[model samples]
Target: MQDEAFFDETEQLEEASSAPTDTAARKRAWRLRINYRFIVQHTPYILFLSGLALVYIANIHYTEKKIWDINRLDKEIRELKWDYISRKSDLMYNSKMSEVSDKVSGQGLKPLNTPPQKIEVEKK
Candidate 1:
């Protein structure tokens, strides 16, 4: 009976020591296991989400570029408007009678001193 009891105790001790190793193996296998079935099942949804994300990023970049273009165009338009106003003012000043006479005086072009008279001929 004593030998039988000793054999049972030895068996229990060995099982207890081997249990930790078995649990460690199971943990390692669990970590390494890949659930390919689940991934395959959700592949369509994953691809759809990836495409949506790409589109969203592209839209953001496009919007930023459009805003930049609009700002640049607006600045260019303002500069062009200012240039037009300045040129128009210069033309207005140069087209005045006094300014024209002053410029032509140096070239010996004098202003007319007399008003023209109109003559009518009688039908004979």
Candidate 2:
């Protein structure tokens, strides 16, 4: 009986020493699992924010290009409008009916000496 009790006490001491190692291993595993879960839960949000930032940068670039294009087109349209207005004024000033008639007369056209006879139309 004395030998058996000594053997049992040795076994209990061995188990006590090993207990802390098992507990430490279990705690390490639990920590790893929690870290993995944290990474998994937030990974998609991180990727989504990164994608949104890239899209916002691209949109800013596109809008800046469009604004420059609009400004260039507006300047071109103003230049064209000014050219059109100047040309229209020149045409109106240079091409008078009296001058046209004088040119026609110079090309052997004579004015009518008599008045034209009037015709009446009846509408039903």
Q: Which number leads on lDDT? A: 1
| Candidate 2 TM-score, C-alpha based | 0.49
Q: Candidate 1 residues 60-122, lDDT tens each?
A: 999999999999999999999999999999999999999999999999997788998899999
True-structure lDDT of candidate 1:
0.93
lDDT of every predicted structure (CA atoms): 0.93, 0.91
Q: Please give each candidate's TM-score.
A: 0.66, 0.49
Q: Residues 17-67, candidate 2: write the lDDT tens digits.
A: 999999999999989887998679889998999999999999999999999
Instruction: Show the colliding residue pairs in model 1.
Output: none
Give the residue spans of candidate 2 off by over 4 A: 1-41, 97-124
On TM-score, the candidate that comes out on top is 1
